[model samples]
Target chain A: AQSVTQLDSQVPVFEEAPVELRCNYSSSVSVYLFWYVQYPNQGLQLLLKYLSGSTLVKGINGFEAEFNKSQTSFHLRKPSVHISDTAEYFCAVSERDSSASKIIFGSGTRLSIRP
Target chain B: DAGVTQSPTHLIKTRGQQVTLRCSPKSGHDTVSWYQQALGQGPQFIFQYYEEEERQRGNFPDRFSGHQFPNYSSELNVNALLLGDSALYLCASSLGLAGGGEQYFGPGTRLTVT
Candidate 1:
């Protein structure tokens, strides 16, 4: 079984400040990792993914995450955030070998951007 | 092209009642998956439908059923719904059954059980 853990339940930062949402996963086999953002009253949108490539992955809205295999972490980071960046972010993982495998998601981290 | 779309933006159902939610996948997508999102939580996978057949499922009960049409559209049916089932139902679509590709999501239907 695979599982995702987001260390932070909520994070508040001022506009244009840097932010990092921590995520860790546990899986017996190799896995694919992803970050998704959900705005109020909306479905989730894919932020970025680490399928099989460089450790660092860049995503939309100037967000990026680094896949750390040894630490079992894929923490999302933004050098600078905006008020529009306020949303709930989720970390997810899927088994690499399984075809059409189900995704396991962490509880979620709510990002609140303040002026 | 339009992204994934789900019908009945919001629904209110009583406990023990049944409900049906519909979804249309994005253009050129063949795989449709459903998920449940409780308040302040991440989406939990319900199941996936490909080629009008169920391909994969998560840890959900039999009360949660679904069907896929030839057009690749899908419907999720929940029988004898419970108050705990009150949540946002999201529909996501992808191009292949491999499940490694990115999935586009619909706006989701908010189901409120009373």
Candidate 2:
């Protein structure tokens, strides 16, 4: 089984400022990592994923994340943020080999941008 | 192509009532997964269906059941709905035997239990 923990429940940043949302996971085996964003009243939208290869993954809306295997962390980052970027972000994990595996998600990190 | 689509964008029901939510997968996708998102939390996986069979399920109770059709469309049925069941039901579709691939999500169906 895999479990995800997002260290921050909420993050507030001024417009054009950089921000980072921390996430950590625990799994016995190799796993697939994913970052998803949910806007107000909308379903989740995939931001990016780390299946293999590079530890640094770039996603839509100028967002990016780094998968640090040694620390068991997949932290999301953005050099600058806008008011439109305010939303809820989630980190998720699923076992790599199991075809029928279920994704375990973190509680969430709400990003609030102040203009 | 159209992304995953869910019907009855919003609904309201009383306690003890049964509710069914529907979903249509993205084009060429065969696997569908259901999730429940509370007001301020991330989505929790309910189940996954592939080839008209349930392949995986979460820790939800037996009241949460699902069905997948030949066309890859699916439905989630919740029996004896409680206030806790009131949430945004999301449907996601992916193209694979397993649901670990990239998934496209629907706008979601908001179910409110009174």
lDDT of each: 0.95, 0.93
**Colliding residue pairs in candidate 2:** none
> Across residues A1-115, which tens digit of lDDT does each residue of candidate 1 receive?
9889999999999999999999999999999999999999888899999998799999999999999999999999999999999999999998888878578899999999999
Every model's Cα RMSD, please? 0.7, 1.0
Candidate 2 lDDT by residue in tens digits, A9-108: 9999999999999999999999999999999878889999999999999999999999999999999999999999999999999888887756788999
Residue B56 lDDT, candidate 1, scale 0-100:
94
How well does each candidate superpose onto the true structure, as a TM-score?
0.98, 0.97
How far out, in Å, is residue B21 in model 1? 0.2
Model 1 over residues B42-109: C-alpha lDDT tens digits?
A: 89999999999899999999999999999999999999999999999999999877746888999999
Give the top-scoring candidate (DockQ): 1
lDDT of 2 by residue, B40-103 (tens): 8778999999899999999899999999999999999999999999999999898875535888
What candidate 1 gets wrong by more than 4 Å, as runs, is none
**TM-score of model 2's chain A:** 0.98
Docking class of 2: medium
